[model samples]
Target chain A: MLEIKGLKAKVEGKEILHGIDLAVPAGEVHAIMGPNGSGKSTLGYVLAGREGYEVTDGQALFKGRDILALEPEERAAAGLFLAFQYPVELPGVTNATFLKSALNAVRKARGEGELDAMQFLKRVRGIMKSLGMAEDMLKRGVNVGFSGGEKKRNEILQMAVLEPRLAVLDETDSGLDIDAMRIVADGVNALRGPGRAMLVITHYQRLLDYIVPDRVHVLMGGRIVRSGGPELARELEQKGYGSLPAAA
Target chain B: MARTAQTSRVTAPAPALAAQLARYAGLKDRLAGAGLPWLRDLREAAAQALAANGLPTPRTEAWRFTNLRPLHDLSFAEPVALVGSEAERAALALLPALGRWRAVLVDGRFRADLSELDGLPEGLAVQPLASALHAGAAGLDGLLGTLARPDQEPMAALNTALMEDGVIVRVAPGVKVAERLEVVSIASAPAERAIAFHPRLLVTLGADASLILVDTALGAGAAAYLNNPVAEVDLAPGASLDHVRVQDEGPAALHLATVYARVAERARYESFTLSLGARLARNEVHVTLAGADGDCSVHGAYLAHGQRHIDNTSIIRHAAPACRSRQVYKGVLKDQSHGVFQGKIEVDQIAQKTDGYQMNQAILLSPEAEVNSKPQLEIYADDVKCSHGATVGELDEAQLFYLRSRGVPAEEARAILVQAFFGDALEQVPDEGLREALSALIAGWWEREGGAG
Candidate 1:
């Protein structure tokens, strides 16, 4: 379960998220829909504990614990994951090496035994096969020359491998084609269970069609002005975000 | 007293140059092949040049970023013959044994007892430089001191003036050396005194011959010493040579090395220097593509920490048409260490259609760590394709955050990124085993200097 009470944040001198309150309970998925520059991505980043985004006020609670004061790694160790909109390219680090280091670090922090090379390889290969990724992708540098679709797929693969309790999907479908969106959706759908939760951030209603969020919230003017069930996405798609309530 | 002082000041070179002159003056009688007229003349000329130029000061154009004042102040004694001990042999065992053909040089003198030269294929000759000189080897007529000129390199000039012993390797025309050749140079100076030795290596690969050379220089114990080595390589038409040099001297050691190479038509030459030791070290390489279609690549990686100063300077000349050259140098500095990379590529008028590329990158892990990178390109041919770039920066914060977000600790994340930064340059090594050995060496260095910093 995740809770954000009056999540007000700012980048530089400008305020982005202005006192927004939202919550997604266990075993459910939520979608935050907004127009451009509506601070949808800011919510995802602020929850992931990224630096430079000053949380002017409010606290983010995951599993009844405040994560705002933890470092990014500590938050990650506490079962939080952020699928970046744009994955950074690591020039000389192979994807396999990066994943192994990350998995082991998280496992160690959680007081669990680390996987050996063979065990790790077997598990990774299985997940990669299910995701329809070629084995060579693991051998290449991390996202150095990956295509848009491949990057999204790689991010999904990482999410599946890490298995965080609360996953934040930040515009995962922005640059993807329809087929890529379907594949990413299928990957996310495969990971859905009673013990996990997801917050999907998107600018359009097309992604909601694949993931089918349990609830939809319309974020406008740095606040969530509307909240409804799945039917709200269809209504917004038909009428557009221009019909949202004015800011307080 | 004033008249005497004036006379001495007028006659004497600068203090540093005077010290070097005095050292070389005392070393003249002990130099190898002193009876040989040509060798004597070479030493005399070099001594005069060294006295004229003195050691390169901070004001010198080539050494502006590197100060030799520390090297100038030390008084280096002539290297004495080292009697191999159990400790020395034990120390040598720590080096990576990657090659089959191995030669060991203790204190710059070839150690036949420690060498393994049997089973060499026909048309291949490997022997000590002193033996080759004394025996009047047939190829010695015009090979020694040909590529490295004293006027161009003063430290090389100093090396020439006091040269002692080294190795001579020759591969006949059309002969392919199947096994890699290993040359291990170990310096074990006395604890109280600083010793200096010049080791010269001449490698001549005949037409159509192929060879791989791995040269490792290390010091034993905690003694202070100077290991000055000059390696000259001549690759004939259609020949190829892969050279890997690792300098892992002692903490109190000073290492100055120069490599001169002449690549012939359709020949290929590749070299990589891994610098990880010495209080102060400079590895200079000069390569010339003498014939058309020649290809040459020079790459290096340097790690400096704890007041260490490491410099990698290279000059590549494209003298023939349709030649290609590449240079990539990377460095990581920490804890008040300094790293310098100066690479110059020259394309002559006759070398039309020449393609040249050079890149230098550095990562400073500490606030006091410094790096100076200079890349120069001189093209007389208008049609040549040449590009050069240099970058100095701290570790990428975004990359660090990404790695850390994955649960990697701050120190582990930094070590991984630093290794990756050097991976681009290390991949240039042609041999996989040697490359892996060097990579492991870099990892060990990171564990010591990179993790905490």
Candidate 2:
């Protein structure tokens, strides 16, 4: 469902991702594990078409289309989702308003009818119930005063609501506790199906324990030096990334 | 040319002022209260002051951020009354009726036919200024120029000299009017002629009286006109006045309003202004808390785009002990539009234990969009607590991207974020209908204003 060929990228004139090749076939979940400053987050940002993440020399094709030419919103409308490391705080916009606008925009772009308030509230309430989120968050400003766990849960709620074909989770587990991780994992794991693809970027192996990936790739020195299955994460955890291949 | 020493402080006088004064030199004789001795004296004194002081210039400290060259560049004539014409009907049709007790002023002249004043309570009096002055409303002479004087402000002086017709609202003591009152001021000058009108809005609330007045102003003409209104409010002891002003002028007009409000012992005066229109506009409000335990709140939000300039200048005085005041002003500027907010809070030495707070914030949607905010606090009381702050910025980049990342278009995301900036300011309005009206104006500004070019 997603393919990156020589995915070289840079930020602020400093190259972060250099000559990387990765592929995630339809219906499979892939995990990109890396240590600090390993360009794991860079890959996610570049794929999502975020501004300032310069794609100097490479092509990232999602569902047979090179998305580098599309704007961030266009990429999103085309079923590309990036769960940000830090969700932004929108002071005046209610969570329900933000989520509704987003879902309707995506749906309308796909030639589907928009959901009315009643239909939206029903679906959102059901999802929030399963995610163990309070209903009052809907009336408050989007992420304005939310705790870390609530913000992440909101991201997951957005992912579940959008139901994108490909999802790029960037450091989604950074600030989450073990219990919160389990709930988020359950939500993400529930989204795993035959038509969906995910790229879980992480620095630790704890998150993978809940939502096991079909494939694991160790990204080091801006390059994916090793590729293996679920066992690779355990091996890397046992022997830290310092013991891996240093050749870029 | 008779220029005051104070007038010399105003840089080079604009030729438009000279031309305008020459054109209106004979207006005093044709004004509403022409034959009355006291009223005639008031107009004559104001006319002299208007000629001597002219208008404020950029050199003036209070007018530093806003240049009146645009106002001084164009000469304006008194608007021809369209009281009973098809044009008046069309203009009246455009005004949104907010409440049952409503008054419509078309080109500064009140239309009794269009107004609903049949069943007003005995103590509540709402009538046209022309009629009130003709019938000699009790104590009208003493209250007209008490708070706003001619030599003190040239704009108010001009208004006083050329003042034709407005509304007079007075509530008797111990009367609590539950229904809301509305005043809709519409400017409908001909497409070819530039018109100017000064309407005096005098409001008085007797002791223990309460009233809510919604004042809305707008313009509907292809040509530029000036709508200069001077409002004087007097609140008696234990009385309350919740005032809301919506300054939604047209693109081809100038709106300059001056409001002087005084609150007495244990009285409360709260006002909210939502300004969204006009090529150039300034709504200056001066509020004085005259007695102990008086509460005052002056909050507003302004949205400007294109080459428009909108300014909100205010001064709040705590004259008595234990009084409290709050001021919150927010503005959003796009394109090359300019916004200015100058707020001052003064606490007198006798006003011990006074509490005052003021905050002004602006969001510039365009790189070329500009904002000038000056929040001042002058406290002479040793036991008073007062604070003021100002901030200017663009919309948060991270916030914008986050909204867009969620599939909301860049423009829609921006509207959402900018509307958020006005949330708390809108919440300051207690009336739901008024708040909703203000919200619609805010949303309309975003919907139609072409992105900063």
Candidate 3:
């Protein structure tokens, strides 16, 4: 479960998310559709506890706890995952090692025994196969020379492995081809369960066709202007957000 | 001389002062009586220049970065004569078995009993400089005196004035020695804390002949000993040679060496220097590509910690047309230790098509640790590619956070990055065993300095 009440966030001294309220219970996929300059990415980053995002007002609660005070790593350990719109390239560090370390860190923080290297490799290799990622990607430096689509796909692979309680995919399908988009959506859908929630943030409705969100919200100027059922996504896909009625 | 007078009433050149003056005085009279007239004049000039310049002071330009106050602390006179033991002889036997033609300098004296010459090829001769000096090889005096300026550097001058016995390897025209020439320089006990060694080597490879020179220096005990060494290498037209120098003296020892080399037309020379020793150690190497199509590659690595001061300075000159030179030096300084790398690549006007690159990088784990790196390039040629880069900094915080975020402890992450930092330096080492040994030594130094992974 996730909740945001009166969330007013400013980046670089300019307010972006102004007075927003939202809630998502378990076992549901919520799509946040917004036009350019709509603060959708800002919301995702703020939820992940990125630095320099001044939370001037409001509190974000994840799993009934204030998530605003946690560091980025602490938030990750607390079962909150943010698939970045663009992943940072880390040279000289293999993806397999990076993922295993992340997994063990979270496990250790949660009072679980650390997985051995063999155990980690077996499990992560299986996840990679299911996500349609090549085994070679595990050996190279993390996203050093990855294609745009490969980077997005790598993000999805991380989401599946981490298996956080709330997974927020920020524009994961933007630079991806149809096949990559489908693979990414399938990877996200594989984690759908009764105890987990998903927030699919996107600019276009094409990705939603495969992931199939249960609820849709139109975010404008850092606030959710409209909320409706799944048909709202299809409605906006056809008629576009320009013809939508003004918020009351 | 300075330390003895300052600490105690006893002056320097105490126990051996009379013998010291007697040894050089006798040698000077003998050279004056016999040998080439020109070489006799050169030796006298070198001695006179040394008496004037004296031991290097911190004020000297070449010794600016390195302070010799510790060296001046103890007065050094001629060491009492020391003989080799059976254990020392046996230990000298297992020396990597470099070549059929081998030369041994024990306590600065040439030891024929510990040398091997069964597999030596013809047209190549490995003999003692003492014999070569008496023979018609006065050309060595010319090469040594001209290649390195002794008056300019006191240590080099000291080595020249107090010169002892070492090997002189000469490869004749079109003669390629299939085996390597191993020169093991050992310092004995009586020479322990009191003596200074000036072990000199001269290696000349004739046209089209190839040779390999392996030099290793070993010291005894915790006493203060100084090994001031100088080597001159000459490569003729179309000749090739590989030189590997390893200095691993004892803890309280002071090792200093300078190598001057010349590569002729279409000749190639590759040299590497690895230093892991002494309280204060400095190795200087200057090389020149003297003719067309000459190529030179020089590399060095020094790992020091725990108050050790190591300086490696190299100058590679491209003096001929169509010559190329490459220099790569890397170091790791931990604790309160200091490491210095001052490398220069000079290209003259005739040296067109010259390509030179030099890079020096260091990882400072502690704020107290220091690394002074100056990579300089002086070019007078119009058509050339020359670039120099020097970087001195700590590890990247972002990479560190990324590693720690992955569940690797902070210590383990730092070790991994440090290993990668010195990876290129070790990779350049040609010998696997030596490379592994150096890597292990570096790792041990890191851990000893409280770097736990």
Residue runs of model 3 more than 4 Å from their true location after superposition: A1-146, A149-248, B1-43, B77-146, B169-195, B211-224, B244-252, B275-277, B426-441, B450-453
- Model 1, B141: alpha-carbon shift in Å? 3.2
Reference-based lDDT, residue B20, model 3: 38
List-wise, what DockQ does each model earn? 0.74, 0.79, 0.19
Better of 1 and 2 by DockQ: 2
The better candidate by lDDT, 2 or 3, is 2
User: Model 2 scores what on Cα lDDT?
Assistant: 0.88
- Arranged by DockQ with the best first, the candidates are 2, 1, 3
Q: What ranges in model 2 sit over 4 Å off? A: B1-15, B19-25, B450-453
Off by over 4 Å in 1: A246-248, B1-11, B136-138
lDDT ranking, high to low:
1, 2, 3
**For every model shown, what is its TM-score relative to the native structure?**
0.95, 0.96, 0.71
- B1-453, model 2: which lDDT tens digit per residue? 466766774664557767656655766676677778888888888877877777888877888998887787777777775646676567667767666698878788887877777788778888799887777645687888788867877789888888888998999999988888898888886787788888889999999999999898877665788899999999999999999999987797889899999999999999999998999999999999999999999999998888999989999999999999999999988889999999999989899999999999998878889999888888888998898898999888888889888898888888888878898899999888878877877888787883534
Which wins on DockQ, candidate 2 or candidate 3? 2
lDDT of 3 by residue, B1-453 (tens): 887668663334422333434456676655322466666665566666666655566676667778876676765655555555764565565445544466778766677777676556787878787666767665565564567667666667666666756677889989976666778887653433467778788888999999777788876555777788888888999998888777777677788888888999999888877777778889888899999999888887777777888988889899988887877877777678888888898999989988888887776767888988877889899999988888878787656654543345567567656655665677766656556755675566556653731
lDDT of 1 at B143: 88
Backbone clash pairs for candidate 3 read A101-B406, A102-B406
Docking quality (DockQ) of candidate 3: 0.19
Cα-based lDDT for every prediction: 0.89, 0.88, 0.77
In candidate 2, which residue pairs clash?
B335-B452
